[model samples]
Target: MKKIKTPISDEEISELQIGDKILLSGVMYTGRDAALPQLVELIKKGKTPINTNGIAIMHTAVSDAGIAPTTSNKEEIESTIPFLSENGVKIHIGKGMLNDETKKALNKNNSIFVITPPVAALLTNNVLEKECVAFENEGIEALYKLKVENIPGIVAIAHGKSI
Candidate 1:
């Protein structure tokens, strides 16, 4: 398995291939249906809370229950992927297949999609720290920033290729 650290570099993204297993460490963001579009709007307005460059965003919600992969193909989530990728989000972590346009967008922007296991225990064990970075009124669905180590995932899409 490849061990990757964030913010991942362009060279690292280029080297990844679909189906490659990876252990990701360092910082990552989390968002789901309610928060991602708000983040995109924040970026467009030049008021983003976090620097998105070369960062990884996981499609999940954090709560006392734990964390797990959410369906990334949801309209609210998928619609923001291209824009986020263009704005320098190097990796997107989630579950489910994405559309062709999203695949093309990721390739064009040198970004990739990774899918983690849906098991919450596995994911929560890897999280070292977390904070609500935006949309806190959304509660657990709010955007969060997490510091993690060795979070496991597989490259589901890279360079216009999917597995």
Candidate 2:
């Protein structure tokens, strides 16, 4: 089992393994398909609805049925990667493989892509024993899994900003 703090940096975003365990603590928002495109537009227009720096923005559309995770929900065609990187979003959490365009953006943006299964999200939320927004990189995935890492999942947290 491993731990990471949320709202990380471009440097800390790298270095993660497939079967590593993660626990995130920080006020996080869910960005469904409906919201992502608009958010991307905001990034392009020189603005953002929420603070992207060092934050975990998962890509799961929450429905009355709960967070419905889609494999090919948001590709570069729908929302470009530059939008996300330009806005300083440190991480994107979700399942499914990222398109090559998305991968390029992630690498360029210096944002880590921490994956978690849809079912484990709620449970991972429960076992969040600590808060770590600044960052921690315990291991690096030599063979980075293109697909989502199931079971032993990933977590990242925020260290709260001053009021």
How much lDDT does each candidate structure score?
Answer: 0.97, 0.49
Question: Please, what is the TM-score per model?
Answer: 0.99, 0.63
Check candidate 1 and list the clashing pairs: none
Candidate 2 stretches with Cα past 4 Å from truth are: 17-19, 63-65, 76-78, 120-163
TM-score of 2: 0.63
lDDT of 2 by residue, 26-84 (tens): 54445544566666776568665567776656655433343433443355322543466
Residue 39's lDDT within candidate 2 is: 64
Residue-level lDDT of model 1, residues 1-163, one tens digit each, is 9999999999999999999999999999999999999999999999999999999999999998889989999999999999999999999999999999999999999999999999999899999999999999999999999999999999999998999
Model 1 lDDT vs. the true structure?
A: 0.97
Candidate 1: deviation at residue 84, Å? 0.2
Query: What are the root-mean-square deviations of the candidates from the true structure over C-alphas?
Result: 0.5, 12.0
Candidate 2 clash pair list: 5-132, 5-157, 6-132, 6-133, 6-157, 7-54, 7-55
